[model samples]
Target: MTRLSSPAHLRQVRTGNMHAVLVAMLDGPASRAELAQRTGLTKATVASLVEPLLGQRILAEGAVVNAGRGRPSRPLRFAATGPVAIGAEINVRHLGVTVQRLDASTEFERRIEVDNCRATAADIVTRLADLIRTAIAACGRDPLGIGLAVPGIVQDGAVVHTPNVPSLNGIHLGDQLAAELGRPGTTVAVDNEANLAALAHVWPHRLAGDDFVYVSGDVGIGAGIVIGGAMFRGRSGFAGELGHVIIERTGHPCPCGSRGCVEQYAGLDAIFQAAGKRDLAALLLALDHGDPRALAAVETASAALGAALAALINICDIETVVLGGSYAALFDHIAPGVHTELDTGVLAATRRPIHLTTSAFGRAAVTRGAAALITRRHCLEPNLLLPPGRRQ
Candidate 1:
């Protein structure tokens, strides 16, 4: 069988025409001819690639539309039903789970603000298992997989380290959750929240050539980097620990056994401390109303973030920085401080404008991206999940 080369030059590990067709459809609904033209595949090749998807109910045909005159071509679109994907996030102050289908539509969601920092790993896993059960029920069919968004480093199925949630450290969360759920064919995948957050930008958008930095601010701070439309996971999976970047040589001690780290100054806790407010909602309201204290505290934290980002931009040469999590909510108020610090710290800011934007997924970025990870795996390379004797 002849393999179709990807038109966009993506790193496709599998040799097949299916990936090309799916990638073309991501732009929008397209007819077979349109898909073939865009993907650089022959018309017959497109039909062959699409046949399996249509049979599996992964792709559906819309009504026949008149283009020129002779024959109307039915457009192909991602099916909204069946094969749902699950994504979960374990935050210090919240637990968020998103049930999404292949088309990125939310079927069901559960979010509760429960402080799990002090909760034991077993307890956290138990809560997540219950939530996963609910999501699985909502799916009502064999799901693609479940992806976990953790605030810590994840190596294998275990949490490597987390400064914000110490109880999660050294816990085999993926394996435990799989064992607890005990549902056959329900696979579990895990990764850092920020890394998945970065993947969110590229996943649904399908902008494989974009290069940017995604910074997530919450109880803690972390970064996700996208270079050439792919995630730069670095030599180790621990690449984007932007929070641990040192800002002051002898400043406040950090939970990661460091002093003067970026998180110490710009993290949610630091901003809350600076504002003298125990509640974030109240502080955000005050900042919106132009309260002097709230403004000052947010500005101070934004400056720290900018300082850390300057070094990052220089090293990565990324022009875009996307603020996610709490940062997105406070973007209007804190953007100036980040810009000012960038102008001062970044060497090439004068030549190239440093563009900043808010995440499209907002606080749900990580979990949604986690779900997208599984969807991407299935779309780009379906052979891994193929049933025995199922022809590719």
Candidate 2:
């Protein structure tokens, strides 16, 4: 078998072709010619790559479409039943794990409290793997991969520095979980949870376009940068650190070692503590009843969020900004204030409307994005979640 040569200028040709075809099939079913047209590859070249995928049961061909006068054409599609992928997102006080098919449609999800995320590295990984395994088992599918989304700086697909969860720092989580799971075909990837949430905001819209950003405000605050429709991991692969952006100089202390950082004011733990709540539902109810303390927390968090958005929009100038995570719903209470802040802080106010929206997928955004990552990794390189010209 002749191996495809890596393009001297294109980095890796086989990988590129494989990813392109896989992405196309994941989009739905398409004929070889249609794939060629979509991927800009010759039919012969596409077929060569498609053969191996077919042999591996990764790609399936079915149903002939009569092309007016020619013989029926068999369309290529991805075998969703081939394997399953799991995504685990660990928040400041909760653990969320989800299992979904390779095509990214979720099958089962489980979320529970971990109290203090300050547990030791081994303990966190061990427990997280157990929860993920349970979810995967419930799905009744053979797990093919796992994606871990944690807070802090993720370097080279590992949790390098986690300020929120100190014990997770310096752990090669991807390697550790791969050993623990012991599934021969299972591989693991790790990334910043905020980055994953950001990607979750835009990943589904990639098939349409990739010019958006997601501002994730949960227990902590952070932003995900997507440019040309892909998660833009900067020089260090930890580009979206929106939470730590200094919004105030002397108001509150932040875990990221800064005064008045956005995380300090808008982080969930801080807000919940200030509100003196043991259950989030109770606090939300209090906020609904117009409790002064709850309302104050919401107002303070929203104002800080609005200020952060203003700064982010002014700097990045992306088309759409999505607020995801637990605090996304609070946007309604603060949109007016946010609008005022945006008008004052951003440049050329009228050119791009600065459409601020909340995640349609709600809390499930990150897990869904993890599913999206699985599709991106095992199937295709280009995105396929949204249709072109319809991403908003």
User: What is the TM-score of each predicted model, taking all chains together?
Assistant: 0.92, 0.83
Candidate 1 has what TM-score? 0.92
**Per-residue accuracy of model 2 over 1-392 as CA lDDT, tens digit each:** 33456345343565577677766665678898889988899999898777766765667888778988866889887665555678887777777888866566677888888853668878777788788878877877666577788877888776777788888878888888777777645667788877787766554345224677787777777778888767788898767787887888986887777788888877887778777776668778787888898878767777777788777777778767787787666667556666676777778467767777778767877776766566556555322222344211
What C-alpha lDDT values do all the predictions have? Answer: 0.83, 0.72
Error of 2 at 295 (Å): 2.3
Candidate whose TM-score is highest = 1
Instruction: Please report, as a residue range, the 10-residue window in candidate 1 with the lowest summed lDDT.
Output: 6-15
TM-score of 2: 0.83
How close to the true structure is residue 47 of candidate 1, measured as C-alpha lDDT? 88
